[model samples]
Target: MVVPLTVALGAGPAQAASCSATTGPYQKQVEQFLGRPVDGRQSSADCLAIQAFQRKHGITPTLGYAGPLTWQTMYTMYTQQWAGTTPNKAGKCPTNRGRIACVDLTRQLSWIQDGARLKYGPVPVRTGRNGAETRTGSKKIYWRNINHWSTLYNVSMPYAQFFDGGQAFHSVTKSMWNPPGSAGCVNMRPADAKAYWNLLRNGDDVHVYGRKPGT
Candidate 1:
């Protein structure tokens, strides 16, 4: 479909020989956008939400996974809702209202408000190549592409302190699993970008910890 074509063609194919292009992101998108867990099981509310979401967004009501229209629509909803809510955090946020801190791990994602309490926003993401691995350190967002109308945000890599010239919280092509995949950047589902953007500005801190232990 054109939706798959857009993500795959724009982000490029996965480098992992064992990784399939349409698996992870596909699963992850459905779960998060549908407001369900990644187990493929749906709650009554989730099913209802998906139906309403699809109808409102003009999705075709396919068998599984979401199309580009559904995806875009969900992004709109998340961003709109997040805009009206204040980020729940502990200590002072680095910038952008000192609200939320977004952390992307290989498995789950969580946002901290007031720097203490946590709200789970476990969306999927694409990661980097094996050796090129996403990093675990703090860094500021040097730039942003709110429109994301072009491939500029898709193809570029995110730089990190620990991971060095690699890693970023960026977008990916293929469908993502719980953690998704990327070349090093945090793979943010397109739908989640706007909400994410709401939490920080150009100089806000973005910490990525793709691994465990002394990362």
Candidate 2:
């Protein structure tokens, strides 16, 4: 899909490289993006750091490798989502008395808007897969859990904002891009999740539509 390239929290590629890139613009880019100094080589540590950033930002595969998409994404970290202009491919979000979050399954983008005013988003999100599809339509956020643990999945669901029964909007440090579905929740990057936790509150409305791909 040709999405607007927006992200929720912040904010690669398949396979492994023979070695870390040592001498390149990308080396410095990754280093700066990660807030650390790199040796200008694609070291295993570099791979891990890169993948960690990628995963947190919902980059695909978290491949322990960096490719074009990864590089471009990192390069435009602040510029991409801050323009305050809605994406051409963005879907319509509802206006509410309080905050409303719009999840467009078809476009794979989400944004929070009060009518036409963009408060946040049109950011990338991953919803539940086929049988475990996240519900479509509108619902109110019934609860908020900062450090929620899933007994069923046995995973830590941080910054969880539950809108449906057990499903919620939460941050994932594991995999944001590649997905088998979200076990019926909306998965966001960690930074976006934190931002969302700041923007939304209990009883806020959430609208979800379309279908999650790769089911």
Candidate 3:
């Protein structure tokens, strides 16, 4: 079973206290909402602008903190409403000769970095059944055929494989949308898989771990 994660926006009492001042709270809130970290204390305008951004994401304006409603809106971004919201930044990734990639199989998601900046998630995925679970260990992006499509894998997708072991990340078919239905590989919704593939590069880090707080 997958444990549901209560979106970590770090808005507990400690954070609240640390955010007592104008700079601390505003800075923290902006980073928490945008998924981008801030360097130091921020100005009131920054806080207000962040509040505006939050409103765009369906959250009502408030004291500019990542409170329950804001976090809930962010949660919605990862769930059913993700397609309309995911930023199209296929050209944003910094490409180089070699890079490492990682995935959290249990969470049915992956994380990528172009040697800098931690991109938390676009997390859209499907997992294996009780018999065939997604493996966890070191892996690499052995190929980069952008035109590849999911064939016997059962989904029409821009696909890639690691080590020829048959494990891969690709677009999901209708059958695999539910948990316990995929054929032992990670399955992703069409848009998320494509976006992820675009963000990935050859030799990017791919770490597949077990059950996260929420699968």
Candidate 4:
């Protein structure tokens, strides 16, 4: 996800017309995050930059307002990028566990590891929200459904791999960056979920930890 350098340039009349003029509460933070002029103002350049980021990350509206959700998504991306190859630098996710899938709710990232070697990703994910939070501690992938339909929510959870109760590692049609989150499931992008399905199996160790920001 390389952010375009052209975002700093004027949005032109067409883009400027659609972009939001209202300075959002997170305006200054968003400006600073996007490397725009940090005057805490919503200029055409700022709006365009922010909007480009929103579009890239699947944040809705994309009207270029520097809202809280936009800021939160940006912060999550920053932390994940900073994590680099050492997502478990804090040693929260146990390395002793063989072939484990680790989900760090705090950074909204997930990955697969076999012993000490990294297998898959530290990819971005959407976990359970405030009330319907994804449970912490150790679990195991017990069931897998390639095309599972959630009777509870009346939606499709593709490449679903049940790890803890109703919560599973699955793919959702919506953006992972969408606000709130899943109903206790680990929501992933299509490609990531598919990879997880191929890489993981029933009875594999699944470790979930950390607290999602809003939760």
TM-score per prediction, in order, is 0.42, 0.60, 0.45, 0.83
> In model 4, which regions exceed 4 Å deviation?
1-22, 52-63
lDDT of candidate 3 over 1-215, digit per residue (tens) = 22222222356744331111244323554465575556555444445555555544434433445455455334433543443323223323333523434454433445454454444354556656566666666666666555566567555545544422677777654432342345566666667667677777666656566553222
Kindly give the number of clashing pairs for every candidate.
Answer: 33, 12, 11, 0
Model 2 has an lDDT value of 0.70
Q: Candidate 4: deviation at residue 61, Å?
A: 6.7
| Backbone clash tally (model 4) | 0
Q: Candidate 1: list runs displaced more than 4 Å.
A: 1-100, 104-112, 147-166, 178-180, 210-215
Considering every candidate listed, which one attains the maximal lDDT? 4
Question: Ten residues in a row with the worst lDDT in model 2?
Answer: 1-10
Q: 1 or 2: which has the higher TM-score?
A: 2
Between candidates 1 and 2, which one is better according to lDDT? 2
Query: What is the Cα-based TM-score of model 3?
Result: 0.45
Model 1, residue 10: displacement in angstroms? 29
lDDT of 3 at 50: 52
Candidate 1 whole-model C-alpha lDDT, 0 to 1: 0.45
Ranking according to lDDT, highest score first = 4, 2, 3, 1
User: Compared with the true structure, what per-residue lDDT tens digits does model 2 show for residues 92-143?
Assistant: 5566455688887755667787766788876777778779888999899989
Model 4, span 129-156: residue lDDT tens:
8999999999999999999999999999
